[model samples]
Target: MARAEVREVVFRIRWRWVRLSAGVGAALGGLLLLWGYPQVQAVLVRSSSLRAEDVEATLARAPLLPSSTRAHLGVRYLYDPAIFDPPRALEHLRRAVRESPFDYRNWMHLGQGYEAVGDRARAEAAYRQAIAWAPEYFLPRWLYANFLLKHGERERALEAFARAARAHPEAAANIAELLQNEERVAQLARLVPEADVRARLCAFLLSRGALSAAVSLWRDLDWNEKAKLGLARIMIARGISTEHYALARALWCALGRRLSERAACSDDLVWNGGFELAPLREMVPALSLSTLGVSEEFAVPDRDFDWQIENEAGVMTRIAREEPYQGERALRIEFTRHENVRFSGVAQFVLLRPAATYEVCFAYKAEVRGDPRVVVEIVGARRGVPEENAVLFRWSLPREAGRAGWTLVREVFRTTPETSLALLRIRRVPADALADFVKGRLWFDAFSIHPIEDGVRPAEGEAL
Candidate 1:
């Protein structure tokens, strides 16, 4: 062979050997990857489960994981006080955010981590970033609002809180807890002016006894929204209980105008006196008048104007539609106790003028086996006076030998100088022995109160 041909043959042989070696190396690498991929994924899956042992294993196995895994681990270390490492948690969270910049939750975690370290500026930046990423989310906005509020950025914080509450109304309760003072509450009210949100905030204030804030919020609501869902009634009832008689009256009259019921805002002072309007007890299924037949469902009236029937154990009261004294319904009270029991189960709250004369009238018929006489009385409520001293007027029913059909009972009396509010109540007159506690039924209807013109005293009337 020629020399050139021999060199060419040698080069070809070397090149072929080199190519074969490279091919073998590539195949081995591929096989190793196929064998190891599932194990790596398995470790990651186990770590993601967040169990203590699995997390430890994954931590030892792989130093670099996905953003979500890092975020999870970050949360664990950030919140778990036993293993809490703020620095390490921040490191993990920062890595997670770097790995997946689009994940808003990762940003939120990062913000919280920064906040925990007292890096207010960085924390705010991170929170804003998270909110920018997920504008519709509630938590980020809520957290940002809290951060701002903590830093005394009241206006900005209120705006952020309003946004959060608009997104999720449940946030109102949390905001309420945060803004305990009246100023902050007013600021929040201004920011979130929607009636529903205001209503929720008002309810929270009422529950917390933030009287001024509650009253202010109630005034902000339009007449229609105030009447919605019986919120006005609740506010009035709270006012009466808290000795805010003026506020109660204002709410009652405003709501009456909204409802277009002249009688509600009229001078009668007794709402639903004829028992014509369905009381709250007759509204709900569980607390309805129908349930009174099966079980004695007891609850006070939610509205100040509605009758607040006393929840005495042996007394059951319900609204009866048949044979009402004047209207479609009357209160039917039955006493089942066999022993002497002090009973005052039917009542209504009314606002009255101090030192003014008023007449209370009602019609009733009773069939009694025992001499359980019922008495009507007007007693000053929230007066901090002795029971006897608070009694502005009292009338006892004349004993009935026969079942007298519907009969009228009326009385006139002047109030004490300080009596601005009173309760029109029917109480059982306890007789010696079991006479007053005998099982008997009574029907009451056409209860009414009118300011006595010229302050004239009416002749004492007989009761059935």
Candidate 2:
């Protein structure tokens, strides 16, 4: 009898628990259905499946959706092919905008509504209002910029588009799209004035193997590795043309920016090896001089000057304004009078195949007081741990004790089997190390490096 009573109580408790769970599930489902109403209209509008009456039914069921969604619905009503009501949309969106003056999206939607009705003046006013309400936001400015472009306000539109790109980089991807299409290149290039934007566009062009279009765009632009790699990868595949080969060489020389990381073996693994490029001091990035009239007398800085000047306590380096044997510039280093800097000059770390022969070539002139010589050494060590330095080869050239002309120095050697990364460091003879007075200026120009394949002809270019 007790067991039967317990069974009856267990059945009653299970029934109550099931009822409670069903009620909670139904309530949650109702809330979820309500929450999805705003997005439903947007999805329907995009898919062209929503009618004016359908939107009205949604709004009637739920009035909690934002003014922006309501305004958006009105714009949707304007686009329905069979029996659309743009005038009604204009009114609905206008009322929404008035009620929510700070809502930037509603303002954009209202602009679209006005534009649908041929009220362009009012459309402009609404877009301008949207921009004014949220100046830093990208969407309002992007919409306004596009609207201005259609109305022949192109110059203003271009500047606005640049601002939008700056405000958000993702917008640049869209601008890049317009530039990628060959037909749109001339049109957009003539207007958009941001190097960041153009570089991305150029990168896209080169990646897609649109060499003709890429080259044309490049002539108007500047040195870009991401873009250059696109060229280099093509060369790797299609066999490099002479013009393509030179560009590939230049960019390969530039990626020498990293030292500690083991380098992937390539032909020339020297950053700015020729010293043809340098960063412009203090200028915001702008459009490619393709039309901007920027002089091509300097290394176009992708970020930092490809060749980094080592900063010790008493050393300074600059791009030599004179005596360049290659494109335009060379490196200039100044050692302070009477100050002892143990390591002062330029250094670049490069990857070399272990047991493979390589050559370092450079032309340099020194004007010094202490008969301080210049030492170019290849040391087997990674960056930041010079204590592990292993001297591979050292070329010491006596900086003219008297008046001497530039001397060409070349050191060729085979890296050890364990030496995958090495530093090409240039510095003064050790008067600073020996605690003696030292002061001088060293000018290095026309630096280049090449791997020796069979050890016969000069694989590296002439450091003329």
Candidate 3:
């Protein structure tokens, strides 16, 4: 053999070895990459907060992720200001919807993406598709309604808003805002057919200063309807806060008349004046005279014309049956302990003609101990009236009347010029010593208040 031939063979062998080593190294590197990629992907997946770039990189690497995941990532890219790319988001959301056409959220997001790109027609179509997929769901309806509203499609937007509000009554406030802005309160009855929804709409109107509309809607609702829907007390409160006194008066009188209690619309302005009605402790979902006897959680009070009684310490109030001055029922107040309590528990708000004279008359029988000096006080309750000048009239109950028969007490008083609202309360003037603390029971009945007309005869006592 020649030496040159041997050298050439060794060179060819070295070249083959070098190529083999390179192939082995390449295969090992590919195996390592395949093993570690999932760990890196999982880290990104488990991240507490992810940037738009991170989401984009993740979508690029993991194409086999769920369609919902891809749609969510599209939302991130579409909304994130740092990397807001509507076209890229539209692509991702479109692909997601293509993969899972039944996903309403993907359709909704696609609509938003189309909206971002100023594609109104496609955006509206996508939103309608979402609604078709989930007609009963509120989100799609609300979003679609808002989209219609943004495009100045007023009538279509109102229809959509009504559908959304009907599906979820809590969304009625949104419709109320729209209606208020458009001055479309007259269409509320047609828009919301449900009575409960009307109540909510009325309250919203009142809160938003649509006083005339709220009052009009309230007037159309009957007493039974308001009672069934629990709107009587709610509207009364809203009326007082909004200074809609006529509405408040009408609600109180209507409820009182339905129960056959002592409420009147003609001459008498005081409600339940004869103590024939029980003060409601709470406004239940469904309310009536029969339901008021049961004790429940004390919530908001009927602050209109009904007697607003408070649970005072050491004082118990109820209707007594022992004595009959006018009817079988009489308001009875009993003091259990010797405490110098400033008792103002029994009260009612009465509407009166400003600067007009009226007579307040009542029958009471007392068996009280000590000289607590309970008085019937009529005070001006105008919002900014000073406490010192609030008292319009004061009549003291006999301090020493022990087990006395029914005494008819009468007092004539004139309302202040600025006072159309007055507080008529039975108060026990707080004494300096516990020795003057009142004990025992007092019974009252046949309370009445009426305007004093010209040439009216001044009676010595009132007949209960």
For each candidate, what is the lDDT?
0.74, 0.61, 0.72
lDDT of candidate model 1 versus the reference: 0.74
- Candidate 3 Cα errors over 4 Å, as ranges: 1-49, 174-189, 209-212, 218-229, 260-264, 280-302, 339-341, 383-388, 433-439, 454-457, 462-464
Please give, for residues 1-464, the per-residue lDDT of candidate 3 as tens digits: 66654444343468888899999999999999999788566745742245656666666776766787778878877877877889989988999999999989999999999999999999999999999999989999888988988988877887888788778876666567665562664465557677656665665655565657766776666556753335566556556555567767787676656655454567776666776666543443434222322123322333566787775877888776777688678888888766676678888778777888898888888888877588888887653122557798888877677866888887788877877777888888677655666778888877778999745655677433
Estimate, for each residue in 1-464, the C-alpha lDDT of model 2 and write its tens digit.
Answer: 45644444343468888999999999999998998776775645643445567667666665655676678767777776775789888877877887788998888888888888888999999898988888889988888878887887866776777777767654565755543466454445545555655655544554444555555555555445233333333322221222233343334433333221432324566755666645321222333323212223311222222344756666677776676656677777777755555664577655566788877778877667665666778787532233235887787756443344666766677888876556677876455356565577777776666788756555442323
Name the regions of candidate 2 deviating beyond 4 angstroms.
1-49, 57-66, 179-199, 208-243, 254-464
Global fold similarity of model 2 (TM-score): 0.40
Per-model TM values vs. the true structure: 0.70, 0.40, 0.79
Worst 10 residues of 3 by lDDT: 289-298
* Better model by TM-score: candidate 1 vs candidate 3: 3
Q: Which of candidates 1 and 2 is the stronger one according to lDDT?
A: 1
Residues 405-446 of candidate 1: C-alpha lDDT, one tens digit per residue: 888877787888888888888888577654444557778888
The residue pairs found clashing in candidate 3 are: none
TM-score of 3: 0.79
Q: TM-score rank, highest first? A: 3, 1, 2
Stretches of candidate 1 exceeding 4 Å from the true structure: 1-61, 69-91, 113-121, 193-196, 219-227, 253-262, 280-303, 308-343, 363-372, 383-389, 400-410, 434-446, 453-455, 459-464
